[model samples]
Target: MQGSNWPIEPIPNEHDVYFRVHKNYIVNDGPYMFKPRAFVERGDKADQHKSMSTNWEEYSTPEQTQSEAKIPMDNGVVAMSVGGLRSENLTVNHAPIPTIRAHTDVNGLPDDIKDVEVRVKLFKHCRWVINPELSTNP
Candidate 1:
């Protein structure tokens, strides 16, 4: 969800926070984790120095654990993998929730549909933008 022109808004919900991104552009990326410039590894051999001394016998991989943990994601996706099952929790960020473009029908065509206000939350980094629109009034 990067490299596009769109604005993002963050709205607080009763249980969770909602993020919305404008779909005016063909591509976008944002709400991403930002690692400082010094922490970034570069060049083709950047990953060659990673530590590899962990003992496999004493460590339990995520696949062996039955606990459910929230998978960190960019662009407003709440992904999770638990008990060997991979599930995706999609919010308004991943999809282009409809908005009033002056005037449009329920199917997105110009018509007499009522105009409604939308709220959203997002983050930006570099040339990327993350957007997620709220589907309901809050």
Candidate 2:
């Protein structure tokens, strides 16, 4: 047979891929580990958080770049993607957390979501982060 070609692979989604990285905010936090600059601090036990986040350069959703503010009357903002949520890492100081979605519907939720988006806020930037800083010393 003559040389044959194959079609491009379909992008990862809820059906095939186990993880669903957003096209707008795919922040792989792997780089923030051992930068030669002041960004990273070395220690005897530097534990990798193993998150679906990005480095300092890429853009991230608001919740993906920073933790949500905890207060009585504050807007509920969660710092974890749906995937991080299933790992039982949601909420702080009690109460349900909110998710960054564009609409109230959950049809377009990313596969990264372990559970579901409580509130809907279109993820437009990178801000949420969970880089737990552990002390190397006793």
**Top-scoring candidate (TM-score):** 2
TM-score computed on alpha carbons, candidate 2: 0.15
**How would you encode candidate 2's per-residue C-alpha lDDT over 9-108 as one tens digit per residue?**
2221111101122222233346322111111111212323212322111123334323322321222122323333323332211111123211111123
Q: Model 1: runs farther than 4 Å from truth? A: 1-45, 48-74, 85-131, 136-138
lDDT (Cα atoms) of all candidates against the true structure? 0.20, 0.24
lDDT of 1 by residue, 36-123 (tens): 2111111233323321011011122222211111332212211111111111111211111122111100112112112121101111
Q: Lowest summed lDDT over 10 consecutive residues: which window, candidate 2?
A: 11-20
Assess candidate 2 and give its lDDT.
0.24
Best by lDDT: 2
TM-score of each model, paired residue for residue = 0.14, 0.15
Candidate 1 residue-wise lDDT at 12: 19
Backbone-clash count (model 1): 16
